[model samples]
Target: MWTTGAEQVEQAVAECVELLGAVTGRDWEGVRAGRLEWSCRRTAVHIAEDLIAYAGQLAGREQESYAPFELVLEEGAGNADALRVIGTTGALLAAAVRTTPREVRAFHPYPFRSANREGFAAMGVAEVLLHTHDVAEGLGLAYEPAPGLCDFVLTRIFPHVRPGESPWRTLLWATGRGELPGRPPVAGWRWSNNLVLGTERLTLQGVTPAAAADLAAVGDGGFAWIEGGPVEGTRVGAGLVHQQYEDGVHLPEWGMYVLVRREDGRAIGAMGFHGVPDAQGRVEVGYDLVEGARGRGHATEALVALSRWALDRPQVRTVVANVERGNTPSQNVLARAGFARVAEDPGHLAYELREPGEG
Candidate 1:
C-alpha cells in the first residue's frame, strides 16, 4: 500500500484519461434527459475541472475551497471554457504529486490546507475514483476500477458507511444523492436514497491531564506497590512523551494523553483515550500504555481519575474502549480499569464503563 507519488500520479492521470475516452464513445441524449441526468459531456467536463482544481490547490495557485461545480452550474452547462479548466487542472495535479514533498503544506477542498504529501495523494485518489465512475455510469458504460484503487477508495470512503447501509447507496448519497448519508446534510445538496450510507456515532470527549486518572491506572500491568506513579514526560517505548511530540503530531485530532507517577516518585507509565462527542454531551473512553510501564497498577489509577472527571460532569454518562481479539494485555488492562467486556468487532473487542454515579 506504500506507493510513490510518481506512481499515484500516473495512475490518477490514466484513470482521468480513460474517463474522457469513455465519454467520447457514448451518445449524449438520454444523459441530458435525467435518465442518467446530465450527458456524458457534462460528466467529462466535471472530471477534468476537478483534476485541474486539485492541481491548482497542490501548486498553491488557486484556493482549494473554490467550488468550480457550483460556479459552472450557475454558468450553465456545456460551456467550452469548463473543458479547458478541467484539462489544465488534471495536468497540474499529475505533475505536482510526483515532485511535492509529503510534508509540504497546501490548501485542500475545505477552508484549510493539508500539511503533507499523503493528504494531497489521498485527495487526488478520492477525486479520480469518484469522478471516473460518475462519467462511466453517466455514459451507460461499465467501468471497473483497478483493484488496488478500489481498495483505497473503500478505505477512505467506506468508513463513512454505517451498519445496514449499502456502499452503493452511500456512493449515490455522496455524489449529490437525496439526503447525503454519513455526512451532515448540506442545505443545497439532496442525498440519494438508493445507497447504503448514514451518519455514524463517534462520541468524543476532551479532558484535562488531572482528570485522566482512571485511564492511567490500567497501565500497572499487575505489579503492586506502584500506585500514583510519575507520568512519563518523555518517550519510554513506542509511545512518545512531550519530547516526541512530532511523531504523534500527525494524529492531531485523535490520540492519547498519558499520566504517570509511582508512590515512590519514579515514573511508571502513561495511558490513552479515544471517544466521540456531539452536542448531546456523551463521550466514550479508550486507554493504553507502553511495555516497560506495564504491571505497575498505573493504568488503574489513571482510569479511575479520568472516569471520575468525566462522570462528574452532567454531560458524560458512559465511556467505551475497544481491544483487539486475543489481546489479553489490553483486555486485562480494561478490566482492571473497571470496564466490562461487552462485544467483539471483526478482529477487535469492545468494553464499556458507566460513570461512577450512573445507574
Candidate 2:
C-alpha cells in the first residue's frame, strides 16, 4: 500500500531529477565555482552517478559497481555520460520500487537486511534528494525541498528525540550539521562520535567527578560557549560528575545542566537541572543523547521520572524551561512530558509546568 508517508522518498527523488532538467550542462560551471574543497562537477551527472551507486547498494548488488563509477567521476568522468548514467540509474531504482514489494530483501550499507522494497526506496530517495540539492545548488538555482521532506528524512534517521532538540536540531546532529559543545579532551577515555562520555557502545562507564572536571577542563581552551566556572568540571567525589552548574552569575540559568546517566545503566544519555523553582513550583529540564540512543522515548521517560522527583519536594510547585524558539523537536519533548509554553524571551523562550499535586 502507498501511504503519502511511504511515497516521501519518491517525491524527494523526482523533485531532484526535475530540478536537474531545469539547469543546462554548462551550469555545472557554477557547481565547480562554488565547490567545497572536497567536491566537483555539480550537474545531473554528479547527482545521477551517486544515485546509481546508492541504488545498486540497496539492491544488494556488489559495491564494486558503485566503487568504479565513483572512481570514474574522480578521474573526471565526462559530464554527458555522468548525466545519462545517473539519470537512467536513478529512474530504474524508482521504477523497481513502484513495481516491487518493499519488503523483498537486499544488501544495505548496514549489516541489517533491506528485507523489503520500502527500505531500498527510502535509501534511493535519500540519495537522489541529497544529490539533487547538491547539483541544484551548484548550478546556482534555488533549492527548496518538498514541504515535508526534511521532516520526513530527519524523523527516519535520528534515534534520540529530546526536549531541547528539534527534528531540525536532531537532523543537524544526525547529519553533523552544527558544532558540538567542546569539552576538555580526556586522555584515557575513548571518544565516541559527538558525546564526550566513555564509550562502550551505549554505556557510561568511568565517568567520575574527576573525569567530568577533566572534560570541562578540555572545554576551557576549546569550548567557547561553555565557560569553565567553579562547577565547570568540579568533581563531587562520588560516582557522579557535576559537569555544569545551573546558576545566573556562575553560569546562565539557561543552556546547562548536571550531566547524568549511569555509565552501565539502561538509560543512554540524560542531564539533571537544579535552578530555582518558578511560580508553578517546577524547575527547568533538559537533556540530549548520542545519536544511537534516540527513538526509544528515553528522553520522555527520563523527564517524567525527574518531574516526579521534583514534585515530591515541598518547596517546588512548577518547573521552568526555555527551549530555543522554533525548535519543534524539543517542543515536542516538552509537550509529551506535559510542559506547556507560557512565555518568551528575546533569545531563549520559556515553558511552564505545575508539578503533579493532590487536590
Considering every candidate listed, which one attains the maximal TM-score?
Answer: 1
Per-residue CA lDDT of model 1 for 236-265, tens digit only, reads: 321321112222121222234334332232
How far in Å is the alpha carbon of 237 misplaced in model 1? Answer: 14
Error of 2 at 257 (Å): 33
**Alpha-carbon TM-score of each model against the true structure:** 0.45, 0.39
Q: What is the Å distance of residue 148 in model 1 from its true position?
A: 1.8
Q: TM-score of model 1 relative to the true fold?
A: 0.45
Per-residue alpha-carbon lDDT of candidate 2 for residues 1-359, written as tens digits (9 for 90 to 100): 12323366556656665665555456354344232332335445545655565555545544323334452444555555555566577676666555653223344434222223444554555555555555655567776666455554432222122212243333333343332244222223211111122222321222212223334454221111222222322222211223231111111222223233343323244345544465656576656544555575656655665666567677777766677887767677778888878888876778777855532
Alpha-carbon lDDT of model 1: 0.47
lDDT of each: 0.47, 0.45
